[model samples]
Target: MWSGPRNLSTAMMYAFAARGDCAVWDEPFYAAYLKATGIDHPMRQEIMTAHDADPDRVAAACRGPAPDGQAIFYQKHMTLHMIDGFDRGFMRDCTNVFLIRHPARVVASYAQKREGPTLADIGFVQQAELFDQVADWLGRAPAVIDSHDIRTNPRDALESLCHTLQLPFTERMLSWPAGPKPFDGIWASHWYNAVHASTGFGAPEGPLPELAADYRRLVDQAMPYYERILRESGRNPNSPA
Candidate 1:
């Protein structure tokens, strides 16, 4: 799954990991991204030390067979982590799905964890770019699903998604044991507290949170990219659905 942070991504990861046939990889490019960019992030040293910091090696692993010989490999990816100069050729080997949330919610939720994020930090632009890249390569638009739709009606949303991927839908995707899984990245401690405490998707979101003007402006910049993908998902962003 290609998604931005704080976008119900962890919950979705847990849902897939719950399925017996799938082996999950969490943000495999994260350490490589950090190592290449030298960006400051929580647990920077530990993350680099603990995870593979080589993007080429990580890409090779991504293209390799599913770990433990599982039938499916579900990778939880951060779109922002695929910075410029990183080759995305590996994506063509996998079925790409873009998971998006409204920028307002993304900015609000992300600010709670890490402050003053730029447009690049939340990944709306890069997501649209990757979506377009995949679509171009496939000669059709790839699957797109809004995180709002997933949280509001997970079964229907995921059922539709699995159908698109030609995978079987299972009740096992609905809930998971509370707490982190063995596959979680070491940075989970800094970012996954709420998801760790939950057994499943949270209640449908309340009204979009109010944001400070600066953050609100950031949302304004991100909305076009979000809405563009939402349209490909076959949902009009303006619709109540």
Candidate 2:
């Protein structure tokens, strides 16, 4: 799945990891992204030291064999990680799915952990770019799931996803052990407290963030990109923004 930071991507990762037939990889290209962009995310030095820093090598590994020879490889990816010059051709080798949340929610959640997140830092522009590129390449829009739909009605949303991806809908995907797994990236320590404490998708949190003036402006800049994606994918029309 192609997702942005703090977009329930980790929860979905846990869901898929629950399936017996599927194996999961959490943000395999993260180290490379941090290395290439020098973006000052939390745990930067720890992340770099723990994984491969070469983007080309990471791409090759992604296109290589599935770990443990599993039947399905569920790669949970961050769209922002695909920096300039990163080879996205390997995307064609697997089914590409996009998972999105409202810009307001994402920006709010992200800001709690880090200050001054730009549009790129939140992954809105990059997600839209990848969505369009994949749509053009496949000559059809790939699956797009709004995070709200998954949180509010997981079975319905996941059933829709499984149909789109041609995968089975397992009850197993609805729940998982409530703790860190072997597949989580090292950076999970800094970012996955909520997910690590959950067995299933939780209730939607209080309200979307009422952003400060600066963050509200960032949200304004991102809304058009977010709406364009919804228009293009034409899914979850009723999902709350």
TM-scores for all candidates: the values are: 0.97, 0.96
Model 1, C-alpha of 89: deviation from truth (Å): 1.3
lDDT of 2 by residue, 1-241 (tens): 9988999999998898888888888898999999988888899999999988888888887885788888888889999999999988789898898998888999888988888998889888999899999999989888888988888889999998998888889999999998889889998888899889999998756667788999999989988878888888875544565
Question: Candidate 2, clashing residue pairs?
Answer: none
Residue 1 in model 1: lDDT? 94
Lowest lDDT 10-mer window, candidate 1?
Answer: 232-241
Model 2 residue-pair collision total: 0
Candidate 1 Cα outliers beyond 4 Å, as residue runs: none
Winning model by lDDT: 1
Winning candidate number (TM-score): 1
126-163 in candidate 1: lDDT tens per residue? Answer: 99999989989988888888888888899999999999
What's the lDDT of the predicted structure labeled candidate 1? 0.90
Q: Please, what is the whole-model Cα lDDT of each candidate in the order they appear?
A: 0.90, 0.87
